[model samples]
Target: IGVGTCIMILSLLVEAYGGYLLTHPPFSVPYYYVLIVTEESLEMIGTSCVVGGILYAMRRVSKERLKFS
Candidate 1:
């Protein structure tokens, strides 16, 4: 959770300073960069993270239950 929180904070900071959607004269982002090619790519990345986390948590919970049983 701590790691995920850190990562989310960093992403927000990057988006805030780097660029924003529906803005004029594209903001000149510096210091760091992320190669996001398209909108769908970003959606895919988020969806993959959520699905993976859910699956991982389910597996962990089932394993712990098995041990108790």
Candidate 2:
């Protein structure tokens, strides 16, 4: 869970920065396209991490029969 959370957070930071750059791009046309691709890829990775983390937590809780109020 910790590892997944950390990865997602880092990816989010990358996405935010990437979006800002896309809006105010300082790179040339080719690099700008590259940035767009990278940004989308990172977002996908982040979403995957979050989903994985949720699944892991659910599995652990079920295995331990833990309940939250």
Candidate 3:
């Protein structure tokens, strides 16, 4: 549970950073192409991780339940 929560929080931070880069490109860079690509990739990866963690946690919980006959 703790690990999952930590992963989710880290994912959120990565997503936010990517968003910021997308919206505000560095001045030294003439083109924003790299920023766009990086942002998209980061967002996709972050979302995947978050979803995977949630599904894993859910499965773990469900599997732990005792069955009553």
Instruction: Choose the strongest candidate by TM-score.
Output: 2
Tens-digit lDDT string for candidate 3 (1-69): 455455556656666655666677564353345555555565566667777878998888888895556
- Give the Å error, residue 44, model 2: 0.6
lDDT of 2 at 63: 75
lDDT of 2 by residue, 3-28 (tens): 55666677677667666766884747
| TM-scores, all models, native as reference | 0.46, 0.62, 0.55
Instruction: Say which prediction, candidate 1 or candidate 3, comes out ahead on lDDT.
Output: 3
Model 1: number of backbone collisions:
0
How does each model score on lDDT? 0.54, 0.71, 0.62
Judging by TM-score, tell me the better candidate of 1 and 2: 2
* Candidate 3 clashing pairs, residues 3+ apart or interchain: none
Candidate 2 Cα lDDT to native: 0.71
Candidate 2 residues lying further than 4 Å off, grouped into runs, are 1-26, 66-69
| Best-performing candidate as measured by lDDT | 2
Q: How far is candidate 1 from the true structure (C-alpha RMSD, Å)?
A: 5.5
Ranking by TM-score: 2, 3, 1
Per-candidate total of colliding backbone pairs: 0, 0, 0
